[model samples]
Target: MGKRIRVGMADLNICSAPDSIITLGLGSCVGIILYDRVSKKCGMLHAMLPDSTKIRNNGLRAKFVDTGLEDLLAMLEKEGVRRSSLVAKVAGGATMFNFSSSSEISGIGDRNVDAARECLKKYNISIIAEDTGKDYGRTVEFYPETGKFEIRAVGRDVTFI
Candidate 1:
């Protein structure tokens, strides 16, 4: 095992073979992971919201799905990983709460998951595996060398996608 790189909420990072990236406390937030098997290059984004445009003056590129994905892709390209070789693994986006009304704000979790899928599709990247939408927070670890996306939630069995 190589060094484990930690990604904070609304942040992003990348790694290569023998290394891994991780993020914690995903509740109504989504973690989008992009990896290239050929190059063993991987990137993870902890997106807190679905869109950056929804919030004015949001300068954090990794805080939203749209801009976050764009930045991740660009970063991978700079590392010499081709977009065509990229595949994705997604986790988190738990509902986390029970809301009385069907308001837009109540569906942030769903929106975040949808935004990630749509953004990846726009980039022509296929999502190979996922663990999402339960009413629980998750912590994830992605091993670039093995393309293993490990998901862990309290009281649940660890899953590798």
Candidate 2:
């Protein structure tokens, strides 16, 4: 197995073959993984918010899906991964609660998932797989060399996409 490169909340990382990317404890956030199979280039983002425009200069540029995807894509391109050859996988958009709140503000997980989808769409990159939206947290592991993404959650079995 290759080394697992851990990505913290609101951060992003890009790596190459023989290495993998991971993000843990995705409760109300989204774990976005982008990979280029031909070049074995990989990028992972742990976005804490849906939009960056609504927030301040919190920290890393990957704090929101909008900016995160934009920056990640740019980094991948610089690493020689063609945009047309890139594919995306996603996880960690869990509700984390069974509350009955109907307000849109209550469903950050769904918003995160939607934001991830919307942002990825801008680059014309297709989302090949996803394991999102549930009342549980998730840990994501992405191996670019094999173009495989693994999602592990408490109790439930690990899922590979």
Candidate 3:
């Protein structure tokens, strides 16, 4: 058994072997996990929002989907993980907030999913699996060695994402 590492909100982590990264409390936020099975290298990003365009001076660029995905990919590449061999899995993007307004006014979870998918497409990374879109929170765990990820929704069964 390797050491378990906790990745907090608005955090990004890149690991190479013997380490497992976990993230908890994902509501409208999304968790992106990229892993290279051959090298046992993995990277995880917890994005709070879909875009960073509205946030001008947050300084923490990895807190948004667009920028966070970019940074995660870059870090994986720098760690010697090739883009072609990387497999992506994601979890989160739950509509935790209940708003009676239209989708445009309160679809943060949907927007986050869209942004993550677009970012992955832009990077040419294929998403192997995903567990998203609901009205509950989730906790995700990524095992680099086996390239396995588990998602536990607040009121649902534990599933592999």
Candidate 1: the clashing residue pairs are none
Candidate 1, residue 99: the lDDT equals 86
Residue lDDT tens for model 1, 1-161: 69999999989999998989999878899999999999899999999999888899799989999999999999999999999999999998888777899787679999999999999999999999988897899999999988999988899899899
Tell me the tens digit of each residue's lDDT in model 3 across 1-161.
88888888999988766888999888888899988989999999999888888877667988898888888889988988899998888888888777887576468888888899998888888999988887899989998877889887656788875
> Which regions of candidate 1 deviate over 4 angstroms?
none
Q: Candidate 2 overall Cα lDDT vs. reference? A: 0.87
Give all candidates' CA lDDT scores.
0.92, 0.87, 0.86
lDDT by residue for model 2 (1-161), tens: 77889999989999887988888888989999888888899899999899989877755688899988989999988888899998899898888777787666559899999999998898888999988887898888888888888888889898898
Clashing pairs in 3: none
* Residue 29's lDDT in candidate 3: 85
When 1 and 3 are scored with TM-score, the better candidate is 1
> For model 3, what is the error of residue 145's alpha carbon versus the real structure, in angstroms, after optimal superposition?
1.7
Comparing candidate 2 with candidate 3, which one achieves the higher lDDT? 2
C-alpha TM-scores of all predictions: 0.97, 0.94, 0.92
lDDT of 1: 0.92
Q: By TM-score, how accurate is candidate 2? A: 0.94
